[model samples]
Target: MSDVTPKHAAALVALDWGTTALRAYLLGDDGAVLDSRASPAGIMKLPAGGFDQAFDETCGAWLASHPGLPVIAAGMVGSAQGWVEAPYVETPADASALVKGIVEVTAANGATVHIVPGVLQAGAMPNVMRGEETQIVGALAGDAALEHEPHGALIGLPGTHAKWAFVFEGRIERFYTFMTGETFGALRDHTILGRTMRATAQQDPDAFIRGVDTAKDAGHAGMLATIFSTRTLGLTGQLAPEQQSDYLSGLLIGHELRGLNEVLAREQSNLAGRTLRLIGNEALCERYRVALERFGCDDAKTVADATERGLFRIAAQAGLVRAAVRVN
Candidate 1:
């Protein structure tokens, strides 16, 4: 085989193969995103060993246009359910330890490819993360706040499966995962809450504030009773359908906030002295900021796509691409 030519050497591709979508990002050596392509070939939609075909079909056309560019994949594409399983590396492992090259997978059409690895946690009840870790790394890279105080920052990533990571000395020290989104979905759609609450209501900030106050005072032990109150309130004609949804949202977000509050209280006793950064969708982050303020922590900020940027940072740090590059 001959050496990679100048054309190949000039550019690199980073694949953020999420569970629901396959995103191909073309980045220059300086880390700027020159172009991007996306498809619905997420791992969740594929069958066993389905990534081989999905990745090829998704990227083949693009690769044909720009031949010989090396691709580095991250996220669910490296899971046991993905085309290739890149086993998890534990906490404190640097970008290089988790860095994996192409897996040389053979597609149905005989095309070759590669996949990234997920990070694993070791303990009695072991935990693991596939693609999101890369995003967290990317977020850390872009945030001067996180970079400066790498040892004592708590990151809240809100989504279906919200992730809270503790970074110490620029390495992931400890982290916890919560099924906030899944739980809320189950409660709203599958439980009694669905009957009284409409999913389309605009969240009422007043109700949300009430819920936060209740959470800080009542804690998780009172959640079930609080949840049932929504139904009771409707029966008594005290809560409207819109208010019911707000109540439920408050209950779930409050539960999450309480859990996080406990962690923060224990982790940082001097809460008045430090700042807690919240990164996620703007709307959701604002809601969280309101809740955090209710608990006496007034300093919070929300930023969008912190995860994608974080993942890109990890890719660059791992030598998959050039560092300090900004992707449009």
Candidate 2:
């Protein structure tokens, strides 16, 4: 709790705990943030005392001050490696489904922490997510289009392992995961592509767009054939060492979009008129916006405050928070 948190304004303590970081939010009844805290204490890198200490560091004081504050958490904190293992809710699920899958863990402070479950898309190409499901809930909590549109919505949460979730009538019908950022790191740090690349403080937009254009024009051969150009272009003096990184980034992201485009085409649709939103880092989302514009989905916009809003939304769904009064 900081000086910013006004006296007794918090209605819920929400946490968005992930693989590499932990975010704690003190939220109001209306889903507004009253105060917040963040730590590098992700699930894998907890300190000597582990999850209890990590939770206490950010939330212990708040709980002491405001006894019986409703607490809810999302992300890897609820994974198999986390404090408690909440089972996965299958796809075509909604917030209500998440409520049905909630698991309760009594924290060190004796306060019950409700853990939100992850989503599993099972079958031949099985996929699972823990934290991103909460972000998706945050993203779609109060969107207007999802209320009336049959076409639904698409949200892109870009990161080391980027997840693009598809929502139709408020249910996550399906989604895709792209290891673009992780693969980019491995290629730039471990692969032969690292041999000719230099780190740059600034991004090379021209080189990045060049790689994207190459993908759009000649990518029918797929990424395996195109990624080699990152090295050859630098060796031939066509690309500077500093530019190769972003160019490779563009190449990888371009292929991702290309695959997404293929998926859309299979559904008799394209990015041209899709209702899309991006919920993640602003700068990375900006890069995605640029790449997406090139791919014809020009209307994508980044959303803010979705995590806290999502936690509150699910809390309300689970009867942990009182609903706001509505009048006709």
Q: Choose the strongest candidate by TM-score.
A: 2
Looking at model 1, the pairs that clash are: 75-131, 103-114, 134-311, 135-311, 137-310, 138-309, 138-310, 138-311, 139-310, 151-169
Ten-residue region with minimum lDDT total, candidate 1? 319-328
Candidate 2 accuracy as TM-score: 0.94
Tell me the spans in candidate 1 whose CA falls farther than 4 Å from its real position.
1-10, 47-49, 100-114, 220-222, 268-273, 322-328
**Which pairs of residues collide in model 2?**
75-131
- Backbone clash count for every predicted candidate, in the order shown: 10, 1
lDDT of each: 0.67, 0.86
| True-vs-predicted CA distance for residue 176, candidate 2, Å | 0.9
